[model samples]
Target: MFSRDSRAETRADTAKPGAIPTQPPRFSGPIGVVSSAAAPSYQPASPDRPTSILGPDISIYGEQLILKTKGSLLIQGHIEGDVHGETVTVDDGAHVKGVITARTIAIQGGVKGELKGSNVILHEHSVVEADIIQERLTVADGAHFEGSVKKAKNASEVTPDLS
Candidate 1:
C-alpha cells in the first residue's frame, strides 16, 4: 500500500553536512493561503476572446452537423452543416454548405447556404450563393456572389438564432 504521508518523506535529508537539499521547500498552510505570485491563475474563456480553428484536412458531414462556439471560429476545412460563433471566418479554399450565423462573418472561400451576421464581408476570392441578412455587407471586387442581401437598420438589433 502507498504511504499517505509522502511529504514527510520528501523533507530535506539533513544527515550529511554541506549537502545540497534533495527536496523542494513545502508550503504548510491551506492551498489558498499561497500568494498569487506562487499560485497558477485560472482564467475563464470569454465569448469574444478565444479563437477556434478547423484545419484544412478535416471534413464534417452530417444532417445537423452544427458547429457552435462562444468565441471566434476559423474554418479552413469543409463543413456540410450549420456554423454559429461570435466571429466566423471561412478561409480561402474552404467550403461550407449550410447556414452560418455569427456576429461577424468573413468569407474568402465558397458558401452555398444562408449567412446571417451583423457584419458580413465577402473577400475577392470568395464564391457565395446564399441569402444574406446583415447590418453591414461588403463585397470586394472579384468576389462571386449570387445571393440577395437584406440590410438591417441597427447592427445590434440583428441577432442570428444560434440554436
Candidate 2:
C-alpha cells in the first residue's frame, strides 16, 4: 500500500536534473476579479491583441447601432450600424451596411456604406460599395469595388476619433 510519503518521493524522483521545482497553487487564497469599481478599465489597442470580434452567428440590425472601441475589432457577422475602432476588419462572408471609421480598415466581405481610415485595404474576394476616405488605400485583384476613393493629406485626417 502506498503512503503520502511515497507519493512525495515519487514526484520528487520524476523531476529532471537542474529543472526548477514547482509548488502546488494555493486554491484557498482569495482570487481577484477584474472590475471597473476597483481599478480603471484598460482597453488594449495594440497589434498583439485583437480585442473584439463579432462572430458569424451574430447579426446586429437596428436604426442606429453604434459600436465603438479603442482596440482592434474583427467582424465575421452581419452589422447594420456604424463601427468605430482603432483597427477594424470585416472578415470573409461577413456583411456590413453602415459607416466604418478607424485608423486601419481591412475588408474581406461585403460592405455598402462609407469607410474612413488612415489605411484601408480591400482584399481579394471582397465586395465593397462605399465611399472611402483614406491616407493609404490598397485594392487587391478580384476585389469588387464600386465607389469613389478620396485621399487624405494627413493620416490623422482619416483617423477616427476614439473618444
Candidate 3:
C-alpha cells in the first residue's frame, strides 16, 4: 500500500525539466484568433518579376514583356508595346496603343494600333483606329472602326508566282 507522502514526493521528482509527468493530459479547445505584438510585414511571393511601362509615342528598342498570365488580363494603364498571346480581351474603358497578336481577340474598348488574330470580334461602343488582319472578323452595330482588314491567306495565295 502507498502512503499520501510517497505520492507527493513522486510528483515532485517527476516535475523535473524535460520530463513528462504521469498525470492525465489536459486539452485546450480549438484555436480561434492569434494575437501579434508587432505590425505585420509584407511578404511577396517567390520568383517575383518587375513590371515595366512605356509612355505614349515612346518607341521601345526591344520587346517589352507585359505579362504572361493565365487568368484574365486587365490593363487600365497605357501600353505602347505589342502583345502576343493565345487569347486577349479588352474591357470597355481600356485603351491599348500597340499592336496585338493572338489566336482570338475581342475588343470592347478603344485601340489605337494594329491587330492580328485568327478570330476577331468588335463589340458595340468599341472604337478602333488602326488596321486589322484576321482569319475571321465580326464588327457589331454602333461600333466605330476605321481600319482595313486582310483576310486569312489561302493555299493559292501562298502558292503564287506560277505564271
Candidate 4:
C-alpha cells in the first residue's frame, strides 16, 4: 500500500545538506478566553430563593423522581416524576407524567397525573389527562383536558412546601 503522507516532502532525511527547511504556515484567529479569577466573586442582592427551570434538553425517566423547590418551578422539558414547588408552571411543549403540587399551577403543555393546587389554569395549548384538585380552576377554550376536577376543602391549605 502506498501512502501520500510524504507528499508534502516534510522528511528531514530527504533534505539536502545546508538547505533551509520549510513548514506549513499557521494563521492565528481571534480566539480568546476570559479568566474569572481576575474579577471579584458576585454576591446575592436579596435573600429570595431563585426560580428553578427544567430546560428543554432535560429528560428524566425510569424510576419515579421527586423534585422540590422553595421558589417557583418551571418545566420546559420532560419529567417523569413528582414536583413540589411554591409555584409551578408547565410551559408549552413540555411533557410531565407525575404528580404536581403547588400553590399556583399553570399548564400549557402535556401532563398526565394528579394536580393539586390552590389555583390551576390550563392554558390554550395545554393537553392534560389527569385529576385536578383545586379551589379555582380555569380551562382555556382551546385547552384539551380529560380529567375530573374536584374542589379542595381548604384551598389555602393546599401548600407545595411539604416536609
Each model's backbone clash number = 0, 0, 0, 0
What residue runs in model 3 are displaced by over 4 Å at the alpha carbon?
A: 1-72, 154-163
Residue-wise C-alpha lDDT for candidate 2, range 1-163, written one tens digit per residue = 8334654432323568776657531111101222223321224334554467787999999898889988788788999999998878887799999999988787878999999998788877789999999987877677899999999877776777778
What is the C-alpha lDDT profile of model 3 across 3-54, one tens digit per residue? 3466543342346787866753221111112122322121221233221222
Q: What value does the lDDT take at residue 59 in candidate 1?
A: 97
Candidates in descending TM-score order: 2, 4, 1, 3
Candidate 1 whole-model C-alpha lDDT, 0 to 1: 0.74
lDDT values, one for every candidate:
0.74, 0.75, 0.55, 0.73
Cα error of candidate 1 at position 54, Å: 0.3
Clashing pairs in 3: none
Ranking by lDDT: 2, 1, 4, 3
Q: What tens digits encode model 1's per-residue C-alpha lDDT throughout 1-163?
A: 7335665554333336666666543221111212323331223235456666787998999988888987777788999999988778887799999999888788878999999888787776789999998987877677899988888667654565556
> Against the true structure, what is each candidate's TM-score?
0.67, 0.68, 0.52, 0.68
lDDT score at residue 93, model 2, on the 0-100 scale: 93
Better of 1 and 4 by TM-score: 4
